[model samples]
Structure formats: C-alpha cells, structure tokens
Target chain A: MKNQTVLFRSPVPVAETATIAGPKEKEGPLHAYFHYTLEDDLLKQDSHEHAEIRLHVGVLKQLLNRAKLSPQEIDCAFAGDLLDEIIGSNFAMRELDIPFFGIYNACATFGESLILGSCMIEGGFAERVTCSVTSHFATAERQYRYPLELGCQRTPLSQWTVTGAGATLLDKNATSKIKITSGTIGKVVDYGIKDANDMGCVMAPAALSTLRTHLQDTGRTVDYYDKIFTGDLGYSGSLLLQKKASETGIILHNHEDCGNLIYNRIAQNVESGGSGACCCGLVFNGYIYDQLQKGRLKKVLLMPTGALLSKTSSLQGESIPAICHAVSVEVIE
Target chain B: MILNKEEQKVYKKEIKDVAPKTKHISTLLRAFFTGGTICCIGQGVNQVLGILLPSLTEEDRGGYTTLLMIFFTGILTAFGVYDHIGNFGGAGSIIPITGFANSIVSQAMEHKREGIIFGICSNMFAIAGPVIVMGITASVVVGIVYLFL
Candidate 1:
C-alpha cells in the first residue's frame, strides 16, 4: 500500500478539546422541587432499556444545570439508542420541552448525529442543538447481536458498548470559548470480522479514511492539534490501527490518537478493555474539558467513529464495513 | 473475595503502584457518579426536544431535527462541558452521542499522519465500527425471532 505516498497526501490539523467545568453548587439551599420520586422498584431486573433511559434522563438534567443551561433555550435535539423504537430516548425526553430529531448508526450514531447537528448551526438554521445516544449491557446485547442471558464467552478483544450516553450542546455564537469549525463523514470500509469480540480488525480501516479527510479538507498536518482521539477501538484495535496505517506509508505519534490506549479498566477488570461511545465522552468531559478550561491546551479535533453493521448482514455472512464522522472543534480564547 | 496463590502475588506487586498512563480519578465514586451526572442532560435534551420540535414540526418532516439538536450538543461539547465530565466520570460521558463526536475529531488531530487513508482515515472508525456491526445485526436477528414468536 505504500508507493512513497501519492505525493499529495494531506496534513492533519490539530487543536485542543473544548473545555467546561461543572458540579452542583454547595451554597444553595436544599433543592426546592417537591415531586421528586425516587423510584426504587426498577432495580430488581437486569439493565433494561427503560432503566438505562431513566438513569440517563436524570444525568442530563444535572449536566445541564451544571452548564447553567435551561431547556427553554435549546432549539433542537438529536438522539439514538440500541432499542428499535428509541424508547430509552423517547420516554426519557417526555418531561422536557425542546425540538427532537432521531438518528441511528448503531455505535456510529453519535457521529451521524454530529454531522447533522453541526451543519444546522453552521448553516445558520439553529442557534443550538443537543445530541445524545444510549445503551446498556442487557439491552444492547439483546438488541444488537446476542443475548447476555446466554452467558456466552467473549474474546479478549471484545469491549463493552459503554453502558452510558454523552450529550453535547452546539451553538453558533462561539461562546464557551470553543466552537465547531468543520464536520466530515467517513466512507464505509469492510474487513471480514465475524466474531463480536474482534472489533479492532473491523474498524481500523474506516478510521483511517476519515482521519485523512480532515487533513485533506483543511490542508493541515498531524502536528497542528494538541491531541487526536478516535471512538472506541480498544487496545487491539488501536494497535492494529498503528500497524495498518503504517502500511499505507504514514507514521503517527506513538499512542497519540487511538482511543484504545487512553483508558484502561486496570482499575476495573475491563476485559480486552475499553469500548463504547461513551468512552470518548467520559474522557473528553472528565480530562479534556478541564485541560481546555485551564488553558492547558488549545485547538483540538474530535472524531466520533462507528462500524456500520446490521444483524441481517452479519447473519448472512457479510463482512463488516465501518465509517466515522469527523467534526473539528477549537478553543479560541 | 480471595485471591489465588499466584494472583495474590501479582496483586501485591502492582496494587500500590501509581498508573504509568495518566493521573485522572481521585476516587471511583467520582469517576462513576460524575460521568453519570452529565448523562442526565442528554435525557433532558431528548424530552425537551420532543415537545418543542413536535409543535414546530408537521407530521413527517423532522429533517433538521438532528441539526438543531447537535448544535446545542456541540455547544456543550465545545464549552468543555461534556469533556470535563468525561475525564472525571470516565465512560459515562463517553458512551453518549456527544462523546462519539469528540472521539473521531480528537483522534484525527492526534494522529495527522501522512496517509489520510491510513494514519487518520483508517483510524477514524478505530473502535466503534465493530460494536455497531454487532449491535445492528443482533437487533435484526432478534426482530426476526420476535416475528417468528
């Protein structure tokens, strides 16, 4: 795959992840809302779809409060879930008041939504939009490709779908000292992977495609940004990413971008360790956001990635093809 | 829980050693609960959008819905709102829609290798593709089984 390059390979741009810091205010009196019902009955069963939704609904409310954002100010909503009816999201949002848009890309749902969501703001169609996706151990296993109740063994390469959801609020004013500058959609790439455990082998190719697109579109190189992070490839996938990309005549900063090497469950018995759309979310929200707010880093690129596969195709013995959505955000202040 | 003979030795060897990777979590509770707190926003956005969009939308024309929603999401993501929660909270912030967006662009800028097709492009879908493939395929099979039932 290396032909001394095509002589015109593009440079990748760089920036720091945007920043936000939030936590409940301690000085306030006890929360005045009276009707809060702590429904304890749902704890009896496995991690169901509705249970996940309920958990996520409460999480978003506090997150928004921390951000000092109110529901009335948001103009639109983009969301997805492993459930067919998107029931987790649908029911979770029943109590709030904002415009809703539904989208699906399985693991890639976040990226798909980001492309559409950012375009809305850039196109001047809306002031701000909130996007989200959800999943759970039991719900995803049952809905996606297998049933967790079966207790089948997973490979060392397998990663969890990350039983949580991440939400981002995008706006046009360039407030928050960060802004969305661009979005790139990745094309589907196929690698024959049948076992659910071996995701690294399947997704590396597509991740390569979009990373290139971002650089080519802007005529920049890898050194420009503070960090480059991919979605949930885990350890094996990230290694393969380095190996495969090297084949095409390119070398990257060791352990610079791939998501696999970032967080390890060394703390939690994470098998093969690190999977899920939320993996990146947690890292960005936890680590990257603080760094940005502190002015520790500036100019970052965030790409939400996905492997596009359906049950019919896999059962039919089809190969797995993947795609990624690349959206660039910069911290300007 | 009891550790086996060899397992006990291994645990003793590494337990107190600080992580060579990064200095992140101060406590497990902070990581778990903090990530969790942010997810509530995604849920709220969903509920809020359902009402606001339904009123503005006709029967079958919610094309710009995702766009509208993401702009708000983008703001949260951009302001470091979501990212901060992600680091302290861990996976809770990552599994959601906003985290997905942050993953790709962050990686691309991180790598920025010479071959867009290889360095950046190939890695873009680095982790997520396989999960989706598995999830979608499984959902369809379940749908089939449900139909047969």
Candidate 2:
C-alpha cells in the first residue's frame, strides 16, 4: 500500500450493477440508464424507511439476477446508508442470504464499500462480493432536517436527499473489461463549517483533500483520469472544490459531481442538487457504469464525499467533519 | 487534515464567496404579500364569526379565529399543500400561527409509525418545543415585571 492508496495486482472486475431510482429521479436526464424506476417512492410501505429497505433489497436482487449468480455464490456484501445505525442496509441484508458488512461514512458510504469489496477480492479473502447503498428523501428529511410536511422553507444551500438504491457486483473470475484499478482512503477533514444545509461547502474540502492525496500517492496528474466524479457536492460545492483545487496548482478540468448531474436543479426544485448516500450510488451504477461499458469513458476516478454530522452535533454547534474515498476504475484490454 | 486559524479563515471566506447569495429583495416581497394575505384571511374569519353570533364577546371572536386558522392549517398540512406555500413564501408562511400548527402537525404525521406515546406524542413538539419554551419564559418575565409595577 502506498500511503493511503492500494494498487490491486489482480484487478477485480465489476460484473454487474443494478439501480432503482425514485419517481423524481426517474424524470432526470439519465433516467434511461437506471435498471428500474419506482412508480411511487413509498412503494406501498407504511414509512419511507421501509421503502428504502425495500429498494435496497430490490437492487441487490436485481444485481444477482443480472450476474446470473445466487445469493449463495456471493461471498460477502458491503453496504451502508445515511440512516441512523444504517438500518436501511441492515434490514435489507436480513432478507438476503449473503454475509454482510454494514458500514457508514455518511454519503461517501458507497465509495467505502467499493474500496473494501475490491480489497476483499484482491486479498484472496473473497472471490465474489457485492457493494450497495441506499437513501430516501423522506427518510433522510425526517432524520436530518424537518419533517416532510413541515412548512419550513429549505435554505438555498440545502440539497435534496436522493431517493434510490444501487448495487455493484464484483467478481475475481468475471471477464468484464471494467475493473477496479486502485483506491485511496480519505482522511476526515474539517474546516470548521457549522451550517448543515451547506453540505457542498462542508464536503468540498474533504473531496479536494482525498483527490490531492490520491494524485500524490499515485504520482499522477489531474488529467490522468477521464473524469473525477465527486459524490453529492451539489452545484456550489463543486465550484468551491474546483476553485480550491486550482488554488493549490491542481486544476480540476474534468471534474463532475453526482449531485449536480442527478437532477435539473431549477426544474426539479432541488435548490442546490441531489444528495444522500444514493446520490452517487445511482449515478455510478446507472449512468457512469453505462458510459464505461460503452467505452465512452475509459478511465475514471470516483471520489464519494461524506459529511459526518449528526443532528445532535449540529444542534450542539459542532462543526461538520467530512471524508472522501477515491476508487479508480479503468477499462482493461 | 488540519488547518491553522489563518487557513481556516481563508477557507471560510472562500466558501462564502462561492455560495450563491439568496435573493433577499424578492424573498422580502413574497413574504410581505403572503403574510399580509394570511392576516387578511384571519380578519375575514373573525368578521364572519361576529356576524354569525351577534351576542358573542370580542374575546370569543378572537379565540375562535385562532382556532379556525389552526384548523385550516392542519388540513393543508395533511393534504401536503402548506410545504409548497412555505417553499415559495419562505418566512412569510413560517411566521404565522399556521406555521406553528404546521410544525406540530407535520411532526405528528412523521412519527405516527413509531406508535402513539413514543412517536407522535413525544415528537410532536420537536420543532415547536423551543418556540413554546421561549414564549412562556418571556411571558412569565413580563408578568412578574407587571406585578412589581
């Protein structure tokens, strides 16, 4: 391992991916790429939490079906969500027979799971692994901010929590050209931002920190990858990251944020952009994965950024600490 | 990663510079109109009550108007309309008695799945709790001052 980065000798192939987007996300530009789109976000469940769990289960099942593998064939699964204690992933795992590892790093959970799953495959610990994440707008709203029906106005900086789940299946034996090449673990970076609504500003520094570390460790320039995709740094946040990166002499010419790409901000009424754990999950598994498969994008760096702030911490006036994990995916001949 | 005070200050300033500024003038205008319309509706309700019951005291009409506003807000909240009003009106919709009803009603609806005691009842005041506390505290202080006077 070179500092925080791991270069896999035998790159694990991404065999299959499945995504289930919500009603609102279904209307987005990349709607056609998703494997399934929910007719109703509630899915007839009594609560949004249960609906999120169901979405998680649906995506996992879809991945298995696409890969033609049973739950028994999968050695282990890594998953997480934005919910307290990660109940979305936990309850979903209960319905599946695969061994599970429940993890959390806020919205960057998908990246953490990908890195860990790839490590398991590269280390000879597991032959086949599944990494998944989920998030629901209503559930996240009730937990992190105001109730769904509350007549409180959203701040201009506030992001809409994405309602969806995505899962990726990695196999050592799969002949897929798309493979996990390397990964860089992020350090928790806090620049003393207190406003939870301005998450893009909060998480942008962490994304920049991880991106810098990844470049330093790999000895690669910013142009090494076709694009560097950050998780949920809505519009303003991505601009902040770009400005800050350029200030440090690292120009982010090919940087795009999943939050920004997932929704039409003005038309969708998502003030900033789409956020939550599934923000990157859906975009990566659906849109980015499709691009890679079609050879439109050969090399890509996926850096999922997370803001580690709880309701109690924000209420207590503690600053938000953020983390970002970068996994380089490439198409190998 | 750690940054010194100076670096933190610089970064904070950069964040502020990058963030999109809120449209203050437009927001103020919207708030003014929305709040004024709501107050007008309250007055209209009071007048209707007065005409309906000629013998009722002024205090009774005032109390009933408040009740009517809360009831209307509760219905709008249940039907999921007030949140959109809030989205457009911003502070206009949020500074009225309707907003208070919305705070309590929304919480109750959100926590209904957790069961009555621990869910709806406990969380009902999640947002309104602070407002109620501050109101009572200020009122008590004023009452004591009046007693001395």
Candidate 3:
C-alpha cells in the first residue's frame, strides 16, 4: 500500500506515560499536568546541548519507573529530537540497553514515532515499545534561527520553541484501555512559503491535507473523533487550517492545536504559541493523556505537523516544505 | 502532496492575509530617529576625543572615535542591554559601528563552548560576513571607476 493508512486489528494499549518540561513551560497553562518540571532551561547542565540530553533521559527514565519496568525489559525504544542529527535522542538512548530506532520528522516526530511503535507491536516484532521526543528552546534557537547572545527580536509571527520531552510506553497485551486504532503517514507538501519566521503558515497546508486524507482513508467523518489536534500549527496555522478545510467542505468543529493549547494565548508572551517537536509531545502526554485517563475524553485524532526546512535550505532561499502524520487513539472500555 | 502551479498561486494569496502584518510607517519612524540618535552620540564622542587628545590629527581622532564606539557596543552587548536597544531602536542600534561589534562579539560568545578556534573565531563573522563581502566588492568597483575617470 502506497502511503496507505494502517489499521491495527489488535489495538496496542498505552501502558504508561511521562513528560518533563523546562521552567518556561512549567509557567504555562499545562504546568500542573507535567510529570516533572525543571527550574531552569539548562537544568544545571554545563551547556544547552547537555540540558537537551537530560530532558530526553529524564522522560524515558520516568516512564520506565512509572511502568515499574527496567530499560533492559523494554523490547525497543523509538526516539527523536529537534537538533542537528537528533543528538539529544541519540545521546540519551545510549544509556538505555534496548534496541533504539533514532527517528526525525522535525516537530511531527512524536506522531511519526508513535505510528512506528504501534506498527512494531502489531506486527509482532516487539512486545513493549517506548516512543519519545525532546526539544529545548535554547538548543533549537541556536541551531535553526540564531545565537542566543545576539538576542535577536523574534517576530510576532514566530512560534516559541517548546522546551520539554515526552515519552509513552505501549504494550501489545492490552494492559491499559487507551489503544491506538489507525494512523496515516503524511506526504511532504510545499506551498512555496519562503518566510522562516512564520512556520505556522508554512505548516498549515500540510496539516489540512493530512487531516482530509486521514478522514478519507479511515472512512470516518469529522464527528468520529472527539477531538482533533494538530502538532504545532500555533494560532495562525490552526486558523488557516480551519479556513482551508471548510473550503473543501470538511469542517473541523472540535479542532485544536498543541501549539495553541500549551500556553495561555492572552496571558503569555508566546507570540503565536508554542512550537518545536516537543510541543505536541508535551501537550498530548501531559494534558490530553490526563483528560483521557480521567474519562473526560474518548476518541482523539492527533496529527503532529513538521516543517522540513534546514538552516542551509532556509539560508539558500528555499521554500519551506511540511509533513503531518495522524494517529487515532481511543479508550475502548 | 505537492501543489500545482494553480494551487500555489491560490495559497500564496490566501497566506498573505493569514500571516501577521506589521505597520511600516511607525517602524520606519522609530528606526530613523533611533539611528539618528546613535550617529549624534558618535559625533559627541568625536568632539570629546578631540579635546582629550589635543595634538592628534583629525583623521586619527576620527579613528579613535570609531574604536570607542565599537568598544562601547561590545560591552553593551555582553551585558545583554544592547538587545533591548536593538528591539526598540530597530535599525538605529544596527546601522552604527556598535551594531557591527555587537554582531561579532555576540556570535563569538554564543559559540564559545565549541572552543576558541572552531567555535568563537569561526562564528565571529557569521552575521557580518555578507556585509564584509559586499563592502569590499563595492569599494573595489568604485576604486576602478575612479581610476578610469
């Protein structure tokens, strides 16, 4: 099947979850939901790079502890980060003795990792799989945009990079009721957007395309999912998606973006809202997961979007290309 | 999922309305006055240097004033105060020699952990590189034209 949606006959259950965030994120609206929060972005580490590694390790370790399983007991670990070469996930996974699949899909990495992890379990390749992603504001800023010392003023359209990490443990034996039903892998779509500062605008089209495709592939309507969430489209992207989706006659009534959900839009100075790979990771694992566990929410269609632009491409006057992957999770009581 | 040419045209137009728009007139006024104030301060520094170094030539005094501005900007950048000026002043903080110093020193500080040679020295010219390249090129062109004339 070429770019077909995967439907699991035997649903894989979400066994455990953990999220670790920085001080800035802890100050946001979802602060109470995080499993752990750091006092500083650096986490007392010697450098921002080291701090990013600590974020990944912290979430993975916390999830292991919560699940009461050792790292050696896990069948596989799928992880990623928004750094050059995904150094945060790579370096952190070195501490775990389990088989590691280092993945990268920019901000959409969590959705990518989740789909793959579910496939591994459903295919009988692994019994227990851990999926995780990490992103640090300081580290990401230095790599993608500019150096911290320059203190360049961020444009109003710019989305703040989320400083956090999120991990979830999935088991094939139906240990927990929260199960992944289906997923749709996105294709890279470019709409000729050149501005690097307005990432939300660049990514919205991809999000819309994936949303429409996911619904079509699964033979589901907008009402099928209780909540539809996009990764880090922020305020502008979410609005743009709503506008575009309506034009195609598919209205998303219960739609929200992790970028918009992570912070208080009116109170916080997060211009367009939170972004980065960890934006969705933190919100879904922290806020959305809590809502589901409490039986307040049931079916969720989580689509994490990513703009695939490197520093080199953006510098060379290239338009931004984006992708979004959709995964449906339901609490089957 | 790539868009066709027709689809792209529609997206480009739609996105223009979707993206945030900044007011140009206000920003321009702020930049102009801020930049003017910085030049005025440089002139003031030049006058003070002339009084302190009475025997120095006019050319030497001008050179010293530039050095002083660069030094002041570097210190300001280190203290993280220059960023506020840059934010409010726009081009005002960036058009002067101080802005040039800010760029180099700030970049060096940012990459300092990578080591002196690979980190600091290598990144020292990142923001200033294009400016240096164009400046030298323009000078060479003007020099040749003058010679021919």
Q: What TM-score does candidate 2 get on C-alpha atoms? A: 0.99
- Report the C-alpha lDDT of model 2 over A1-333, residue by residue, as the tens digit: 999999989888999999999999999988999999988999999999999899999999999999999999999999999899999999999999999999999999999999999999999999999999999999999888989998777788999999999999999999999999999999999998889999999999999999999999999998989999999999999999999899899989999999999999999889999999999999999999999999999999999999999999999998899999999999998
Where is model 3 more than 4 Å wrong at Cα? Answer: A1-3
List model 2 lDDT by residue over B23-69, tens digit each: 99999999999988999999999999999998889999999999999
**Residues A233-285, model 1: lDDT tens digits:** 66656666666567665565633432443334344434444555544554454
Deviation (Å) of A58 in candidate 2: 0.7
Best by TM-score: 2
Candidate 2: lDDT over CA atoms? 0.94
Using TM-score as the measure, name the better of candidate 1 and candidate 2.
2
Indicate which candidate wins on lDDT.
2
* Sequence-dependent TM-score of model 3: 0.95
Interface RMSD of each: 17.8, 1.0, 1.7
TM-score of chain B of each: 0.56, 0.97, 0.94
